[model samples]
Target chain A: MKSESRKEEIIRAASILFKEKGYSAVTMRDLAKAMGIKAASLYNHIDSKQEILSTIIIELAEEFTTGMNQIVNSKVDAIKKLENIIDLHIDVTLRNSDGLASLNNDWMHLEEKNLQYFEKMRQEYEENFRAIVKNGVDREEIKPFNIEIMVFSTLSTLRTLYLWYPKQKNIDAEILKHDMISVLLKGMV
Target chain B: MKSESRKEEIIRAASILFKEKGYSAVTMRDLAKAMGIKAASLYNHIDSKQEILSTIIIELAEEFTTGMNQIVNSKVDAIKKLENIIDLHIDVTLRNSDGLASLNNDWMHLEEKNLQYFEKMRQEYEENFRAIVKNGVDREEIKPFNIEIMVFSTLSTLRTLYLWYPKQKNIDAEILKHDMISVLLKGMV
Candidate 1:
């Protein structure tokens, strides 16, 4: 494998182990074993286990923030923007379930710099939802509710789909996305 | 402190630490320090950290199951029973937020026997909602929808309130409960 591909492979293995066993329980040697490489050879690709966690978390945060930023910047009405946000969230979460799990569950283990980066990305993502909800309310597309609570509740609800959404099922991501957005919008509408 | 009060103090401290830091990050010594006692002193109040986790989890599970059972046995209609279940869920969740957090987030740390007990309580709690939804469908009280999905989604949504529901606010639990139940019922109605 190319160097980049090998690094990605190590990240993938590490993400799964970290999700299952948690960050503290996982070790560099464990990642090496899972990657079918010697423990000493693993140091060539990653500096430490914390480095692996930082890579996975930062990448996932980037994916989420980037997706939301694109949606917010698109030329769409508030309702459509909300729909798109939900779609992007479900898509990212389902596509990167392990990474999402680590983001939610293992984020605390990231180094200080990485933690700040992740938190900033998360706050940016929340701002997207907040803007969408505020715009919708102003347009009378959604019912008047506390903007902060509505935004937090909606995003938190979507974040939790990673825990129970079965990947093997034939459920289309779009359909699930539309259904969730519809129900939440209905409640607010 | 009295022995009973000392035990309560330990559980309370442990729950706060577990919520702030996760199960893997906390140690017996940490709990001891939180309680201002030596590490070995924790043994007098609890057998182990696992024991503390099990106690908190099982207690929450029992509260949920017992509350649901009482609601199930009540003479109210299925729709009202469903509403009551939602209200009780929010009430118990708000009152015992820490315990619920431990149950939802730290359940995997439980030993085999305790895990089984917790699972059984969870299934029983879920069955109450399923029973209500199924009966409502039969009576045409609830709109026709996928029963399994509806049950899981509703329960999962309510169960997650502990993660973010603000306790310091003056929002009335009953009103919040009524609104949540209204939203779910309205969507199906």
Candidate 2:
């Protein structure tokens, strides 16, 4: 494989292993074994196990933050913006199940710089949700409540899809998104 | 401190550390340090870190399961039972916040026997929710939907309170519980 493809392959393997066994339990040798490569050879793709973890979490955070930011900033009504948030959330999480797992469950292993970057992006993403909910409440588009709790509770619950969502099932992502957002919007409104 | 009091203190300290740092990140030495005792002294009270983890998780699981079971078997309306479940859930989570965190986030580190026991209790708790939802649907108290998804999603969302709930500044526990169960019941119905 080309160097780029080989590196991507190593990341994919590491992401799965890290999700399944966690960061501390997974070792460089384990990643190498999973990739059908020697431990020494694995060094060519990644500098260290922490590097792989950092890469996976950074990628996941970028996907979520970018998707949420774009949707929240788009020229749309508050309800539409809320719908887009749900769709974007499900889309990113479903496509990157292992990556999301690694980000949420294994983020403690990130270096300080990487962790700061993630925290910034996460805060930005949260601001988007808060903005939408705040706007909705201001414009009488959504019900009045503790906006902080409402936004955090909705987003936190959505983030946890990684825990129990079955990838093999035939559940249409859009339909599931519709159902979840409908329930949430109904409660909020 | 007496032996029993020392052991309780160790477990309490271990619970806080586990909540903040997670299971794999915490060690026996860390627990000992937190308790202001030597590592060797920890061994006298707890056999291992795993033992502490198991004790904490099982204690929380027992509380949850017992409370849920009582609500499930109660001679009450489905809606009232659902409210009871919500109230008990919030109470257990707040009363044993550290234990709840360990049970939800660190269960994978538990021994096989403990895992089996905890899993059974969790399933039983889930069944209680399922039964309440199903009964509500049959009694025309709830709307028609996939019971499995609805039950799991609602229950799991409630379980995540331990992660982001602020005991100091957030909504009071009783009001939060009332709002959550009201929203859930209204959305379903």
Candidate 3:
């Protein structure tokens, strides 16, 4: 991996602050104070609060988009693709849940071009997910449940893991991955 | 069911406003204007913004508490109890998704005794769910996934149903109930 840049460091700190107080509530001064840097020094590394937010949200959205593209392009079947998607969510959540929080809550605050890009990525992600489910149904490899219901049932849990997983320090990561995939895909029956 | 009182009418309108604007952002003046009543008339039905929030959240929380009590005491097995709990959530969500939005997003804004009461009810609700899942695992009726994982996997979906179910007008309620229970409990594959 490449060495983290100064701007990346500023964005990372801003993501945490955004998670805590929400994007609208957080200011550059608070983020600077949290990083123990002078407020004016922050300007050298980042442009504005909006720039920090767009960076945090857009980067994460692109990361998810890239991951989804890989999984969709892979030779895996529908169930395998779904499992990989779940793993992708877990991997991202574990690495940058604070960033994921901003991605989840503050993406709407993104400016014009960034907002459109993020929304398009999101739309494509859902469509790719839907196609996988639809393929599974067509091939009779998966249950013919309502496509929307199945998608939301799984995605909602995966999406919200950032909020839930951080507090659950006791659950081992491997165990969490194993059990969450099991509970989500295979159900608990 | 009892007839809706004027106070209840005010509370219902306030819940819709709270859902749209969040609890803190909404004001008595906005609510009164929405109701086409003078602001003083709103005072006749409710005490303050705090009271409206408490009424919306506490009443919903207590309603959940009441339903959970019935399921917990029922003579059915753990799986059946879990099914009943799912039905309970759908019932409430269907009846009042708008109110549920406030219950979910604005519960933290509840104050003093109301806050304590809402938290207590919420804690008991989770504890009861945990116990039911634990019982299912012990009886070998449910898979031995991590109890917390199973509990969250199921409850998170149910709790957020209020948000998801409203937009899917093409899906019938009965079909939703059947497919949702199947997808949640029995897996997709």
Best by DockQ: 3
Displacement of the residue B98 alpha carbon in candidate 3, Å: 0.7
Q: Could you tell me which 10 consecutive residues in candidate 1 chain B have the lowest summed lDDT?
A: B180-189
Q: Which portions of model 1 show Cα errors greater than 4 Å?
A: A167-170, A187-189, B1-6, B22-33, B36-51, B75-79, B137-140, B167-175, B183-189
Candidate 1 per-residue lDDT, tens place, A1-189, comes to 587788888888988998888888888888888878899988887788888888888988898788888888898887788777778778877777887778888898888999998999888888778878788778877666556546645665677778767642755666576557665555311
TM-score of chain A of each: 0.91, 0.92, 0.95
**Ten-residue segment with the worst summed lDDT in candidate 1 chain A?**
A180-189
How does chain A of candidate 2 score by TM-score against the true chain A? 0.92
Residue-level lDDT tens digits of model 2 in B33-133 = 88777899888887988999998999888887788878877888887887887788778767777878898889988999999998998888877778788
Most accurate candidate by TM-score: 3
Clashing pairs in 1: none
lDDT of 2 at B88: 81
Q: Tens digits of per-residue lDDT for model 1 on B1-189?
A: 698899988998999899888787899999898878899878887888898899889888887788888889998887788778878878887778888778888898899999988888787777768888888778887655556545655666787788767552755665576557655555311
Please provide, for model 2 over A28-113, each residue's C-alpha lDDT reduced to its tens digit, 9 standing for 90 to 100.
99988897889999888779988889888998888877888788768888878887887777787787788888888778778999
Steric clash pairs (candidate 2): none
Chain B TM-score, structure 3: 0.96
Q: Which stretches of candidate 2 lie over 4 Å from their true place?
A: A40-44, A167-170, A187-189, B1-7, B23-32, B37-51, B187-189
